[model samples]
Structure formats: structure tokens, C-alpha cells
Target: MKILQAPFTEEMMRSLRVGDEVAINGVVYTGRDAVHKYLHEGGELPPGVNLRDGIIYHCGPVVMKEANGDWKVTAAGPTTSIREEPYQGQIIRDFGVRGVIGKGGMGDRTLAACAAHGCVYLHAIGGAAQVLAECVKRVRNVYLLEKFGSPEAIWELEVENFPAVVTMDSHGGSLHAEVLRHSQAALAERV
Candidate 1:
């Protein structure tokens, strides 16, 4: 598996290709439908958060706060990425996000945006919440918790060895598209 650090550079994203297994380290941010919709509708992100060259995760993690006020991640599995399709491309472009981690894959617009913006979409294993959470080293910050609620809040996290596969790359490659085409062809053969 290729090891990657957070705050990825454009060159790094461009170097990645579909099907490459990667283990990510450093920081990543979590956001879901509400967050995407807010951003897409011209809502500004909370001040002090920087997304440029960073990773965006489609997830709703379960977190617990300790007696000393530190937060612990209990579950961090990926959410379905397609749910954010309408806003993903624009979000990547606007925020300069270098990587996106989620379950399943995105659509044509997102794929095109990834290619155009030097971004890659990484697919994390679904239903591996607890296992994934183990990779989170710390909870750096949380935003919009009151406004969007816990699950829909934006979580800034520091992680190590977070496993994922490149299903969409900056070079116009998409494993999801390939699978769709093959499935359609198979259906045609049956018909």
C-alpha cells in the first residue's frame, strides 16, 4: 500500500491512479449531506478551518468526550458518496480539496471535477466503523455541531494508516465507471 500524508499536493494527487491502495496519515475532515448542501448553497465554512490541499471524508463518526475534555473517535466508517454528488465537484474546486474518502463512488460531474482539480476519490471499506476509528489519532476540532447536529457536523481529525483505495483519480480514471459499463453490457447480453 502506498503511504500518503495529509495536506496533499497537486502533484501527489496527480500521481495517484485508480485501484492504488493507499494508507493515509495526518489530518482529514468529515462532512456529510448537510455540510455539502450548506457549502453548495453558498454557506461559509467556520473560520479557522482550512481545506486547501486537504482531504474531505464523507462520514458521520461516533465520538466520545473524555473527562479531561479530549475527544475519542469510536466509529468512523464512510458514508455513501453519491449522496453528495451534486455539491462534491464544486466543493472540491472551491475548497481546493486534494482527496475525498467515502464508500461507493461518485458520478460523472465529480469524476470530471477530480480530473480537472487534481483530486482523487478514495474508497474506504464500508461497515468497518470501529476498525476505521482506531486509525484516528485525535479529534482536532469539530464545527457546526449545534447548527447541523453531531452526525452532520464537520469533524477535523488527525489519523495514521487510514486505509483506502483510489477508485477515482486526477487523470480521468474511474473504477466505478468501468464497473457500471461492464454491468450494463452484461445486462444487454442477458436481454
Candidate 2:
């Protein structure tokens, strides 16, 4: 598996191709619908939260607060990435984001942005929230909790060997598109 971490560079993202399995270690930030819309609408990221060369995970993790006021992620599953298609491209360009982790893939706009901005879209496992949470080594921080609630908040996570498959690459490759193309052609042949 390809190993990835924070401060992802253009060269690193460019080298990845669709279908490459990667193990991402280090920092990642969870950004659901609210967080995406907020960022797209020109809202500032909380102080200390920087997305430059960073990875944004489309997830609404199940978290628990401890007696010490620390946080724990009981589950970390990917949300449907298609929901962010309208804002993803712009977010990648404006925020200098290098990676996006989610499920169900995205649209042409997002793929184009990945190609243009040296970014990659990784498909995380669906229905494996608890299993994936095992990769989360720590809860670093969180933002917009009071405003957007826990699930919709931006959660800073430190992960180890977080697994994902690259469905869209910076080189204009998309496994999701390929699957759709082949499926459509097969259906047409039957007709």
C-alpha cells in the first residue's frame, strides 16, 4: 500500500493513479455538509485549523467525550462524496487541499479540480465505521462543534494506516467513471 501523510506535495499526489491503495498516516480533518458549505461560503476555518496540503474526510464520526474532557472516535465512516460535488472543486482550489477521502465517488467537476490542483480522491470503505475508527490513533482537536454540532463539526484526527483506495487521481484518472462507462456500455449491448 502506498503511504501518505500530511503536507502532501504536488509530486506525491501526481504520482498516485486510480486504483492505488493507500495507507494515510498523520493528520486529517473531518468535514461534513455544514463544514463544506461554510468553507465554500467564505467562512474562516477555526484558528489552528489549516487545510493547505491537507486531507479532508467526508465523515461524521461518532465521538465520545471522556471524564478528562478528551474525545474518542468510536466510528469513522465515509459519507457520500457526491453530495459535496458542488463545493469540492472550489474548496480544493481555495484551500490548497491535496486529498479527499469519502465514498460513492464524485462528479466531473471534482475530478477536473483534482487534475488541475494536484489532488486525489480516495474512496473509503462503506459500512465499516467501527473498523476504520481503529486507525484513528488520537483526537487532536475539533472546530465548529457548538455551531454545527458534533457530527457536522470539523474534527482533527491523527490516524495510523488509515486505508483507502484512490478512485480519482491528479492525472485525470477515475475508477468510478470507468466503472460507470463499462456498465453503461454493457447495458447498451444487451439492449
Candidate 3:
């Protein structure tokens, strides 16, 4: 397993191949459907918050505040990525975000956007809440708390050895589509 520290370059993103195990360390922010909508509607992010060259995780964590008023994520997992396909590509390009972390897979438009914008889609394992949380060493900050509920809040986390796979790459390579094609072909033989 290769441990990758972030501020990942475009070359690094393009170099990742399917089946290559990797751990990512750095700041990753959680954003979901509602957040995307807000952003699309020209909603302003918190002061000094920049999406450019950052990683956006499609998640809505189950969090609780500590006695000292510090927030802690009880459960953090990737949400279904396909739900954001319509806005994802545009968002990525507009924000200049270099990487995206989510579950399931994105579609052709997103793939094209990745290729055009020099980005990659990282796939986190589904249902691995506790396991993923172990990678989150700290919650650096958060935003959009009251307006969009927990789902839309962007929690910035400092991660260490966060495991994920490169499912969609900037070169127009898509593991999900390839797997689907192979499965269809294999099933055709049986029929």
C-alpha cells in the first residue's frame, strides 16, 4: 500500500492506476448535494475558504460536539457520487479543485471535466465509516452550519493514511465503466 500525502499534483493524479492502493494525508473538505446546490446558486463560502486546488469529499458525517464545543465526527463515509454528476464537473472546473472523493461513480460529463481540468476522482470504500475516521486525525474547521443542516456543512479534516482507489482518472479512464463493460460481456456469453 502506498501512502500519498496531499497537495497532490496533476501528474500524481494521472499516474494513479486501477488496483493501486494508496493512502492520502492532508486537508479534505466534506460537501454534499445541498452544498453543491448552494454553491451553484452563488452562495458565498466562509471567508478565506477556497476550493481551488483542494479535495472535496462527498460526505455527510454524523457528528457531535464535545463539552468544550469541539465537533467530532462519529461517522464519516462517502455518499453516492452519481447524485452530484450534474453539477460535479462544472463545480470542479469552476472551483479548480484537483481531486474529488466519493462512492459509486460519476458519468461521462464528469470524466470529461476531469480530463479537461486535470483532476481525478478517488473512490472511498462504501460502509467503512469507522475505518475512514481513523484517517481523520483532526477537524481543522467547518462552514455552512446553520443554513443547510449537517449535510451541507463543510468540515475540513486533516487526514492521515486515508485509503482510497483511483476510479476515474484525468486521461478519460474509468474503472467503473470498464468493469461494467466486462460484466456485460461475461453475462452475454452465458446467455
Ten contiguous residues minimizing lDDT sum, candidate 3:
12-21
Residue-level lDDT tens digits of model 3 in 59-112: 998888899998888788899999998899889889888889999989999999
In the order shown, what is each candidate's alpha-carbon RMSD?
A: 0.9, 0.9, 1.4
Candidate 3: Cα lDDT at 81:
95
Question: Which 10-residue window of candidate 1 scores lowest in summed lDDT?
Answer: 4-13
Candidate 1 residue 138 Cα shift, in angstroms, is 0.3
True-vs-predicted CA distance for residue 97, candidate 2, Å? 0.1
- Residue runs of model 2 more than 4 Å from their true location after superposition: none
lDDT of 2 by residue, 95-191 (tens): 9999999999999999999999999999999879988999999999999999999999999999989999999998889999999999999999998
List where candidate 1 sits over 4 angstroms from the true fold: none
TM-score of 2: 0.97
lDDT of all predictions: 0.94, 0.94, 0.86
Residue range 117-191, candidate 1, lDDT tens digits: 999999999999988999999999999999998889999999999999999998899999999999999999998
> How well does candidate 1 score on lDDT at residue 125?
99
> What value does the lDDT take at residue 140 in candidate 3?
81
Residue 37, candidate 2: C-alpha displacement in angstroms: 0.9
